[model samples]
Target chain A: MIEEVAVALDVGGTGMKCALVGADGVVRHAERHPTDAGRGPAAVVETILSVAEGLAGKAYADGLTPTALGIVVPGVVDEARGVAVWSANVGFRDVPLRDLAAARLGLPTALGHDVRAGGLAEARLGAGRDTGHVLFVAIGTGIAAAHVVAGRAVTGAHGAAGELGHILVRPDGPVCGCGRPGCLEAVASASAVARRYAELTGTDTGTATTRRTGSASDDGSAAGPGRGRTMVTAAEVAARADAGEEVAAQVWRETVEALADGLATAQALFDVATIVLGGGLAQAGAGLFDPLRAALRDRLTFHREPRLVPAVLGDEAGCLGAALLALDQMETP
Target chain B: MIEEVAVALDVGGTGMKCALVGADGVVRHAERHPTDAGRGPAAVVETILSVAEGLAGKAYADGLTPTALGIVVPGVVDEARGVAVWSANVGFRDVPLRDLAAARLGLPTALGHDVRAGGLAEARLGAGRDTGHVLFVAIGTGIAAAHVVAGRAVTGAHGAAGELGHILVRPDGPVCGCGRPGCLEAVASASAVARRYAELTGTDTGTATTRRTGSASDDGSAAGPGRGRTMVTAAEVAARADAGEEVAAQVWRETVEALADGLATAQALFDVATIVLGGGLAQAGAGLFDPLRAALRDRLTFHREPRLVPAVLGDEAGCLGAALLALDQMETP
Candidate 1:
């Protein structure tokens, strides 16, 4: 008998992580492809469809049956309608990606937001596996969150839930990408931290140390070259903070404080059992979690203190989450 | 043939709204009683038990069968544990109210946070009845919220969910009851609005005008006399603002802005279909809803604009919600 598998793809602006995942969530086959979003949405759609077909063909060649397909994208996704409502990253606007994929591949398909998919993967098979209520926060170039309750991630009514990055943390702080001042993402995101550190140190080569240290697992968008050689990543700042550099410590502390405020606000609203910190900044391990946990504790008055832990699945979480969504559709349908 | 009903009670710091509700979500009977919390937790519990018992007795006397009992309280509630974990208003500390009520009433019991219960009611049978995702915000002496999705309120992992009041909207605003500076509750609640107006006008008699106007639908906690005769409640401030009071307009604008910020934060997270405003402040109706709707719209970008409306159930929402909870328990059990 052929082994059953699901085709899963985590589509990002720069690349796509494709995998054939078994019923038990183990990746049977994996591949990568450049998204080349600069080519526009139509080309990106064609690339996604062809890549999915390739994966399905590979599964057949390996004597595996492709049960379903799950595709996750970075944007507002109307999961119920299976439409990619909007995504600035990939230029998707009301694209019926799910129906298109299903029609092309002759399989049931599931579509989800990438961050939510990552959160689902974490809740079901990674750091939050044991918790019923988990909040997966991705802190990279941008900060977003997914609230998973009882193994299901909440897709807000308007497909716009989990925008944790926009919560106002500093009323008079820096302006955010969303055109708001003092947004949590503007102060605590990995990119924000790097920008703050560079601004404070007047050094553009700060990220050089991060690249030198070989900790380049950050989303590529946040790792681009700065104006000068002194540009540093948040990781470098974390290292400097650990090494007792005053300016870096101050920047790191502000990041921690802003993150704590944002997390505390999330806790107040979500009250989840655990908060799984993922994406680039969480790679700092103790550097990020220690102060964040402490500051969150200080901010909470009567709320149950949630366990804050690092995400375990790393970059694989989104693809795995896509697989889980496919698997869930199979079970439900 | 006997009619089946559930005994429901909405317990507050100062009063309790009690009702016997049928399965069709109609109240067969209703009554009110002073909580007299100054008598302490034990006496308050006794009052609760006796009132529940009396309601059950009334159902029997009226030829209706009381199948279950549901009670809602304020503050941290361990709904799963059937415990009122802590409530400053009622001075309850780990009171096993559900079990106690069950033992006395000889029926199945459900315990819930008052606001969550109210939200559940609003979602299932009140203002939000038509929407799958609803956020119920009660802006009284303190602001609190309950997010209801698919007709059930999210109780959070630790049973301390829906604390929307604590989300920081203004970082440098006044200190909140929770010892936090700039909490939404500290700036936008009815009491907060009243306090701000009084401070601006240097008059404590703000609520006096409200009393004179004879619109005392406000929670009694905010109706007490202020230091002088010219004081004003949030309602009075609204009235004054309408009558061209510049100071009142400024105070009201700040309240609206702060509230808008808080609600925008909530909308960003929950992405609910509708936001139902309850409690004393919402009594201003168009005065609150018009500006709040505009401000929320201005703050939101890619997120769907949620409908803002006044809660219909008024003070009865909690009791109605408790009844709904009891009826739901019966179905599940």
Candidate 2:
């Protein structure tokens, strides 16, 4: 009897993670490719199809039958209709990537939102495993979340549920990428933390008021390469905070505070069992979790404190999640 | 032919709405009774059991076969465990309500949260019907909400999901009943609206600062009967606002603004298809929906706007929802 596997691909702005995963969720084979999203969504769709077909061929070569296909992309996904509605990074505008891939590969397929898929992987195969109600939050350049009940992630009517990063945390804080001011991600995401540190340190020896002064550029050049070699990233800031640097400590504290506020609000609404924190910010380990846990506890009243833990899948989460989706698409378990 | 009916009861702080509903979701018979909660938890439990049994008997007398039982109470419910874990209003502490009802009536039973039950009714049979994903918000003396998808209400890890009232909207707003500051209920609940209106008018020609004044009595007496008949309820405020009362309009505007913030945050997280406004405040009808719809639209950037509608269930929603839960518990369904 031939072993069966799901051909899976997780497409991002810069690259794609491809894999053949067994029904048991173990990855049988894995590979990577550049997405070349700058070439436009049409080219990206072609790349995805060819890459998926190649994975299927590889599965056959490895003595396994490709049972189904699953693909996850960063966009507003219409999962029921198998359409990629829109994506800011990939420029996907109403692309029916699922049908196109299914036609090329001759298998049942599932399309999903990238962040939601990553959260699914985390909820089922990573930190949130065994936790029936899970809220998976990824704190990277831009924050995102997925609320998983049992083993399924809720894709809201418009497939835009779990926009945790954009949930308003501060009313008068900062403008977010979504044009909303004081969104949780505006002040607490990994990129936001690094940016805040840079902003404060640039006008050194002054209190961090989050206000602009004469030294800062008009169009925000300090956030760019114009700040020279003095600029530091979020990871470095965590290290500095851990080492007792006042500015870095302040920035880290502020990030933790904002994240706590966002998570508390999340708990009030979701009331999940576990909150699996992933992406770059979770890499800080105790530096992030300890303070965040404390702050979140302080903010909650009657809410059962969700178990806070770092995600275990790392970068492969989306690919594994795609595999899970594919396996779910098969008629047989 | 004997019709199958579900015996259901919705227990609140003040009253219990009991009914026997048919499989077609029509109530065969309905009645109301005082909860008499001051007699304590045990009495309340006895009252619920007797009321449920009476409803079942009433079904049989009406030539209908009672199939199952469902009891909804205002509190922390353990749906999976079939227990009423906690209730501030009814004074229940870990009562095995479902099992007790099942044992008493020799029928299948389900225990659910009151607001969640009402939301289930709204989502399946009321205003939210036909909408795939529904968020039912009840803004009366206090604000509460239920998130229902595909007919089932999401009972979080602690059976505490959909605490929309407690979600933080204002960082510097009034203190909530739960001791949290700036909760949505602190500023947007019906009681909050009425309180604000009174405070503004009492200190006439002054903006509502949410602060206590010398004339307001030191012991919070203004909220009690000691105000010499000056106290006005939320309905009065709404009527006044509609009739062009300046203070009422300002109070209503502020309430709408705060509610919009809360609902926008809810949309960002849940992204439901429709939002059904129920309970006391929803009685204002278009006076609330028209402005709230616009304000919520203004807050969204990438989010799909959820349909704003008034709940059609009125006060019977909870009883009907209880029937839904009971019907859902039946094996044949």
**Residue-wise lDDT of candidate 1 within B31-117, one digit each (tens)?**
999999999999999999999999999999999999999999988888889999888777899999999999988899999988999
RMSD of each: 4.5, 5.6
Give TM per candidate.
0.94, 0.92
Please give the C-alpha DockQ score of model 2: 0.52
Which candidate number maximizes TM-score? Answer: 1
User: Model 1, B135: alpha-carbon shift in Å?
Assistant: 0.4
Share of native C-alpha contacts between chains A and B (below 8 angstroms) recovered by candidate 2 = 0.78
- Model 1 Cα shift for residue A75 (angstroms): 1.2
Which RMSD does model 2 reach against the true structure?
5.6
Q: Please give the distance, in angstroms, between residue B173's alpha carbon in candidate 1 and its true position after superposition.
A: 1.4
**Highest lDDT model number:** 1
lDDT per residue as tens, model 2, A145-262? 8899989999999888888888877888878767778888778876677778877877432222222100010111123222334447678889999999999999999999899989
lDDT of 2 by residue, B8-116 (tens): 8988877888988999999888999999989999999999999888888888888899989999988678898998887776788899999999999999999998889
**Where does model 2 exceed 4 Å of error?**
A203-230, B203-230
Q: Please report how far candidate 2 places residue A315 from its true position, in Å.
A: 0.6
